[model samples]
Target: MHGTETIPVRRVRDGALDLLKWLALLSMVLDHLRYVGLSLDGLYVPGRLAFPWFCLAIAANLQRVRGAPVTGQWRYLGWLLLFSVISEVPYRLFIEDADTLNVLPTLALGLLVARGWQQKTLFDRGLALIALLLAALFSSNLMFGFFGVLLPLAMLLVFSRPWYFSVLPGLVCVAANQWQVLLDSGNLVALLGLATCLIAPLAGRVLLRYAQGASPPAMRRWAYALYPLHFLLLLLVRQIIA
Candidate 1:
């Protein structure tokens, strides 16, 4: 009998990720603008679109780089770290309720979860478990952090499945986006925010169908710039209104 060898499975490329990242960036900008441009009106509905998309983007990146070298992942994480530091002061200045730690910390922790699960390293795995427990316990305060930790596993579950299977993770992802409203003490804006999260991913998935593997480095860099720039601009506007 001929010896059998296990073939390494390659993950399929989903264009939905890039589309989702761009969309999340847009939603985040809109959300931030409400703080700066229209704080009184409660326009958090459309802004709710950002966080889930960003989490999805992190998941997509982890999926693509699963078997690749570690150095690149480290480098990408470095960029995020740098930007998170760069954006924090401005972010704090811009939002009334801005926390000491912003979304980047959550994203970074989520990256650890994804990389740890993908590599199955003892240290990474242990750290991820710890992070997960912490995030779950403190989800109300660490919304993005909690979502980030769970996002990779969710992506892995649906990574190679048909679109129908994705529905399960998609719902979980949306639920993560606006879960506060699910509680008995809820309001109209929170309900609308939940609706927006559910619908936004559909647009992302459709865009990915046509634009997979088409984005260039220039566009990606520009997208990063939008995060801080938008915050600064909105802050300026908010100051004007005040």
Candidate 2:
């Protein structure tokens, strides 16, 4: 356990959280479908929902774990780091000339910061500082850059606030996407993507707050494997279509 204070000492799995994750994963797959040799640039806008929603999940998870003593936080980080490495090969193969590592690393680092904010212990806080320093130093090598690293914390800050307050993380999401050139192109999808990023946190928060009884299947750790698996599946789709 190593006393990471992450997992719930007493909380039950929230169906709402799992539903949010399912939606995030779906958005991610839609985003990656662009690589299947199709003209799905429009998917880019919805894909914009993926990262921010995922950040919200991390934030929500942190909030869920608050007040729990002596958690399996280390195990959560372990799974993220493991997948961050495992997913790299498929990620690079799928995304042509990918300049940054896959999204898991960004999520992993973001988890550190978000959990640090929630936990507030010396070790966790120190780790969070190191994570921030690393994120700043290696923003270019990260899939979503420095802004993405800060998003989970941004989400955490606004999670319990009014819906309109989501704009804080919304700005962070847009920065992570870095789509000003796309916005200049007059693409409706690009414009929609902007709108989606702006409202994703609000949507997710609403989902969790009101849809607690939705009964979605829990997205357990095994779901991590889906990130890499989907890339390979998309590659296969490209080959079939080619």
Candidate 3:
């Protein structure tokens, strides 16, 4: 008892955070809808908000527990790893000529990087190093790649700071979205898409910070299944309608 450490204050759950999760999920669904053969290229712009928002959620979670004891850290990483495998087939089936694994892997690695930055223990730092090495080595085959893996850390860095700090991750979000592909397209929508990516983190932070009042369904571990399930459902709908 002589050496016991004081536990930091645990923040209450924010309804706005839940709202952000739902919005991120909807953005993801909207982004995927483009593959539904609807010629909805415009959906790609709003979809740009999805990954950054998700990363922001990760940052908010880590930020909430800063200096507090981390519970279920392994379990959190386990779910991401498990779903990364589970989601791959559905992801490939939905996106033709899919060049990368599903986005969960990127999120999974990003979680490690952000966690490492937060915890800073020898073990966590080692794990973070491994996550970065994997990201660097497999950038081409991972959805969003190395930059995506870093976005969570970037968001975490600015989680408690003023809004301008969101710009750090905003640029990372754009890079992860593959700006080169957008620029090559040479369309007004493509240009707008770049702006959308650059603004997504700031917009999401604003929502998390100021938006309130609506109680959304708590997104639990069960939501991990939704990533793969959505793709399967979309594939089914595509076959039925197309």
Candidate 4:
């Protein structure tokens, strides 16, 4: 009798990617706490890591879906768009002095650019071009500005190319931030913030490539609720503390 063979199945969900998402979420929360009736000025340095890590996560997801059905990609963009609208009021309420719109819009645009580059479809390219033009027109009005939309594309490029090529996008990430002010301050926290912003993508890439042993809970569609809900929760906390 021939014996039946069992092949080991690879995991569909990546623990390292989930961990990166959790880190980004936590960093964003800590960053927002600075405005939530706390003396958390020191949180700024860690906050610098949030956006780049989120962009890296997007790049990782895009790479994962490279040869899969395009519907998943559209669904991802739909979620970002929905949350971008839903989170705005809560974001504004939570951050009184906020000048630009919420971060989700930037992420959505970034997704378009990354997808366009990956699929190279005429429709995708057209959408990306429109997003780029919109980003340029509203550079000052978008959270993280235009470079924010480009950061994910840069990260996608980094993932598809050699490792050392990450620095180019790292510089772009730094430029998206308030680096000049940090440099002008010339403090340890400021320097650390600059370093974190520049190295976030590289660190995320390393984690994605080597941290397969980790099995953290995967962040899924429900994670979208966290964005607006976090702001509401923080608002309640602030009210209670007050």
Candidate 5:
């Protein structure tokens, strides 16, 4: 009991976060479908929405810890860390030429950074600093690189500020992707993908504010399994069609 704290339970459900999770999951699947032997390159644009939305959801969960115990925070980090490892095999099997690791590690590190900022404790700060340094050092090997690590921190900064300030982080989100190269290519789909990356976080913020009252399916701990399982399911589909 000396070093442990009780994690506070939420009394009300946040439909917005649930909806965002579902949307992010859908976007990810759509993006991956392009590889399942179909002409679904068009899915790329919607897929741009996935990462940003997931980042926002992470921020939202961290935001709820204001003035509360950081008890459950460890579990949150643990779950991400576990799935990050669990998801690697399936992710590699599904995405050909995936030189980088899966996206979950980035999210896990980002969570630590956000918690470090919010908690402002020595341990938290040290952990966040280490994560930041590691992300910077291995930017090429990480899924979203340094910008991905920073996105969650940016979202945390935007969470409590004026709504209009979401644009700053939105820019960071877009930069996380290859927007400049896409613009240089002058491809319509790439251009749209860039726009979606820029807009995804802003759209998620709007939903969090205006759709708070809506009742959506809650994405609980069980949802962690979805990350790896989806890849396997798609792989089966790919094998079947082949």
Candidate 6:
């Protein structure tokens, strides 16, 4: 009965994680849809859902792993590295004027930072430092890739603390949204991005509550592939329509 009871809890968590992930993916697709079909000036608004949702997912995983044996945690990092390579070229080809490094690289590095902070390991500490430096140098071309690296850490902080403390990540997310930079375009989309980043996490916390369950193997396995695949598919659609 104990084992059986645990299964339901695990299913609930995994189900919730998968649900939030799919929602984030859909938001990202809609955001990218602007690149292909609509070009709605406000398209970036919903697109804001992608990064923070991904960050919360990472934090949720970390929380799940909190007491688990840490020996094989690096395996997760390895999988991320594998997909980052797979995703890079397709990502570059799909987005016009996109920076060289893609989101997976940032997510990969962010995972290292979060895991390192958890273990307090010397190797991870060094790696985290190197990752931060690389993110800073590549920031301009990567288009907020560095901010993406910081995002997991931000999520971890918020997850570790109370609701009132959420202001910390909220500020970082807003700053990273580059409101001042967007001021030049004079487009309201930037403001929309800011609002989404601020509010999304609050909703995310609630969504995360239900993320308990069995391993989301199918969803987890497919998600990394979808990152690059979606971009390429959207690019094809855009070309055909054009």
* Candidates in order: C-alpha RMSD to true structure: 5.9, 4.8, 3.5, 3.0, 4.2, 3.9
Q: What tens digits encode model 2's per-residue C-alpha lDDT throughout 112-150?
A: 998888888899899999999999999999988999999
Highest TM-score among the candidates is held by which one? 5
Give stretches of model 4 more than 4 Å off. 1-11
Q: Estimate each model's TM-score.
A: 0.77, 0.92, 0.93, 0.93, 0.94, 0.85
- The residue pairs that clash in candidate 4, if any, are none
Kindly indicate the candidate among 4 and 6 with the higher lDDT: 4
lDDT string for model 4 (1-242, tens) is 34787777865888889988998999999988888787988899899889999999999999998998899899999999999999999999988888999999999999998899999989999999999999999999898899999999999987978778889779989989977988999999889888988888888888888888888887989999999999999999999998
Superposed Cα deviation of residue 36, candidate 5 (Å): 0.5
**Candidate 5 lDDT over residue span 71-154, tens digit each:** 788999999999999999999999978989999999998888888898998999999999999999999998878999999999
Compared with the true structure, what per-residue lDDT tens digits does model 1 show for residues 1-242? 45696777865545456557766777777677667655444657777767666766776677677778778778767777788788787777787686436677667667777777887989878977886887777776554546655765665666556666666556666666646644444778777666666655444445555676665333354465566677788888878988
Lowest lDDT 10-mer window, candidate 4?
1-10
Comparing 1 and 6 by lDDT, which wins? Answer: 6
All models: lDDT?
0.67, 0.89, 0.90, 0.91, 0.89, 0.76
Q: Point out the higher-scoring one by TM-score: 5 or 6.
A: 5
In terms of TM-score, how similar is model 5 to the real structure?
Answer: 0.94
Candidate 3: C-alpha RMSD after superposition: 3.5
Relative to the unseen true structure, what is the C-alpha lDDT of residue 155 in candidate 3, on a scale of 0 to 100? 95
| Candidate 6 deviant stretches above 4 angstroms | 1-13, 184-186, 210-218
